[model samples]
Target: MTCTIFYSTEMPNEQAKVTGGIPTKPMRWAVDYVVKTPDGRTVVQGEKTIQRATFEELRAVMNHTIGEIGDEVGNEATFVSWRATAHGGKKKNRKGGKRK
Candidate 1:
């Protein structure tokens, strides 16, 4: 089985760090990940706080999580088509209808 992981986050701004009044740090980023089928539809996803001190440990944790989900699903799910049409896009009428 294969999986892809994507990460995204917003860093705290200097202004907030200095001027904002908070009892603690503004934010912390845990490792957020998504698991998808072979053709790109999401199967399972989750986030876990950075607990391990090394890269290998973190990778092992993520792999184990994904493996558990895979085992439960029995690896029979098919990939879903992810194509989407544009919203409010213009299209010509084949019947020669009038345009507003």
Candidate 2:
């Protein structure tokens, strides 16, 4: 069976401090995922949160979710397509101009 997945990551406002001269906020990654069949039928969908916003952690969550979906579907589901997006802080202005 072929399935498509859509996922997005959002950073919460909660923060933690680390040992460093510069102040940094501890980011928590919240992932929302949806699994759909070929006919646009949603098989499963839910949200998961990771304490640390690292690539490895995110990947692990995604993999585990997909596995769960496959088991629930009762078939070998192949990932035909997927989409991902990240929502976070605003981008800094890079234009070199005098402040108004």
Candidate 3:
């Protein structure tokens, strides 16, 4: 069996503006991932939030995730591809709306 892995980093976002709200810290970086079989069937997927947003943390999480995938798919499974990306950070304004 062959599989594909997709993962990415979740960027932090600033605190939102709200009335009578206590200021809270911005979100930390997180990793989101997905594993799929050759037939485009989703095997496993999840997101993990980490304290740090470094490459080392990302690598560690990825390795752990892959191991979990292996356990789920068995030893015959071969990774056919990998896709990674980064998401979040700044919120974009909606169309025809005022820019912050």
lDDT of 2 by residue, 44-73 (tens): 666666674444445566677777787787
Q: What is the RMSD, in Å, between candidate 3 and the native fold over all Cα?
A: 13.4
The positional error of residue 96 in candidate 3, measured at the CA in angstroms, is 32
Per-candidate TM equals 0.39, 0.47, 0.43
Instruction: Report lDDT per candidate.
Output: 0.39, 0.48, 0.46
- Model 1 TM-score, 2 decimals: 0.39
Best by lDDT: 2
Where does candidate 1 stray beyond 4 Å?
Answer: 1-29, 38-41, 76-100
Pairs that collide, model 3: none
In model 1, how large is the Cα lDDT of residue 31? Answer: 56
- Per-residue error at 94 for model 1, in Å? 69
Best by TM-score: 2
Q: What number of clashing residue pairs does each candidate have, in the order they appear?
A: 0, 0, 0
